[model samples]
Target: MELQQMRYVIAVAETNSFTRAAERCLVVQSALSHQIARLERELGARLFERTSRRVRLTPAGAAFLPAARQCLDAAERAAAEVAAAVGEVRGRLAVGLIPTVAAVDIPGALRDFRRRYPQVRVGLRVGASDDLVEQVKEGALDVAFLGLPTTARLTGVAARELARDRLVAVVAPDHPLAGGPSVSLGRLATEDFVDLPAGTAGRIQTDQAFAAAGLTREVAFEVTTADFMDRLVGQGLGIAMFPSASVHRLTGVAAVEVTDAPARVEYVIWSPVGRTPAAAAFLDLLDLPGPGGSAAHAARAALGTR
Candidate 1:
């Protein structure tokens, strides 16, 4: 029987009189009597022995009483759990990010967001942009930071452009093109390119730029991870192209300005299928000015770069 029916049976058993039980349950006596009668009929057994002035439990009623109480307790516990999940901010939110985005600004920004919303339990996952897109689409992640134009048409998801990330040249300190104010596209043509893999947005941008400059890409090595790309460049493997944000000094790589490359726009991609309040809070966090958000001012203060 239904949980409400169990509750009705329990109420009638607790109070001896039908009228008293209905008053306690905020139902009319006849309605309560009818519900108990229906329950007894469904079970094919009498639950109570009724007299003119009093109601007492039958053998079947005594057997069912504990079970009825247990059913109601379970139902109430389930309801309370649902209410906690909905009303509280302290639930798990799985967030995904690509290496470059995670390395650049997201880590610091997330640290700040965690400090602000400590009640939220965050689960962070890092992967390639395409992988993160797939995770978001498959409902594996609540939210993700990825490059734009996700496979939403194929998978039913959407993206919002959060910030613009531009490409820049990266190389070792002793490289031949290192001393220039700005290396011309024609001059950069001769250097072997330590490149990103073919499918990545940065790689596509580099391919287009090289084609426009009438320069052929002398493929040096294919490195996908931003950290590894910087490391490969630092070891004098060849010059690599990456978003300016990943230019943070980590593995002895040096970042230089590349004016001719296409800009890489970073976007926040997520599925709304199972969004929680914490996920919305994360979107709001993206709009706030955290550590490096005012990059111009923060950069000037840190690197003294004009």
Candidate 2:
């Protein structure tokens, strides 16, 4: 009828004597008998056969024992799993990221997070800023990195500023423009450009930099993925604009600093605002050195970077 009743039935059956079962269960012999009798009546079946000197199971008792054991086992496993998660000891943590963050520091952070919480599963998803925001808001993702989108009119969600992903112009190394000196914002439009996708904040910043230089940008191509933009620049498809940290492998493209360029702010955002221990651990690790900065700022300086 209930776990307590099942336990009473099992105790009496195992000890095979009312007195011993009562002693083992820490109950009076009469109380133990009443508990077992209650269970038998609830199940509409007798679970034991009593003789003057001893007790033995009815066929029903033999059949029900394993099921009782199974219930106890399942209850124990459930409690353990819940405890592990609340203690930050284990469970799946779903993290979402905009393309740039995924390319920038997530790989190393993921490696370290796994080393610390090997029992916790880390699930990752990459998307544009809008999608990342939506994922966290709908509870589809636990947390994610979003390129700082500062539109005041934007809806709900909490954002934690992570780092600034400085935007820079990228050109094929062999291009005539690549041999030139460090350019200013004014010089940005001299060459035709590979554009960021229209309507995105990155694209707006790219366009404004050219505007500030008193020149108009000519779009040779428009792209969404910074990863692809870098690869394409290397192949000389076109000069691409992207976050400086997201552009790697300088073999074919030179990632040059653009003076007076607007830097994109990156943030780690969560849907519910309050963070899980695992997610908080990840955010804390990001502040460390190594991939977070140049050699001047070692691993210890990572989190200290504003």
lDDT values, one for every candidate: 0.67, 0.67
Worst 10 residues of 2 by lDDT: 290-299
Q: Which stretches of candidate 2 lie over 4 Å from their true place?
A: 1-88, 102-104, 149-155, 211-214, 285-306
- My TM-score estimates for the predictions, one after another, are 0.60, 0.59
The regions of model 1 sitting more than 4 angstroms off are 1-86, 102-104, 115-119, 148-155, 272-274, 288-306
Model 1 agreement with the true structure over 1-306: per-residue lDDT tens digits: 777778778778877888888898898988888888898999999999988877889999999987786566446434433534444343446788877662237777669768866766778997777778778876667678775322223246656666666667777889876766666566677888777677765576677777878888687788777778777778897888667776674567666677676566677766644344455555555552222222223223222233
lDDT of 1: 0.67
Spell out the clash pairs found in candidate 1.
none
- Candidate 2: lDDT over CA atoms? 0.67
Q: Count the backbone clashes (under 3 Å) in each candidate.
A: 0, 7
- Mind giving the per-residue lDDT tens digits that candidate 2 earns over 1-306? 677777777787788888998898788989889988988888898889999987999999888876886575445435534543444344456888767663347778789878977866789987777777777776667667777533222356766565666677789888766867566666666676776677675677666656656778678878877667777788877786667777664446887777776666777676444444445456656652112212212212322434
Best by TM-score: 1
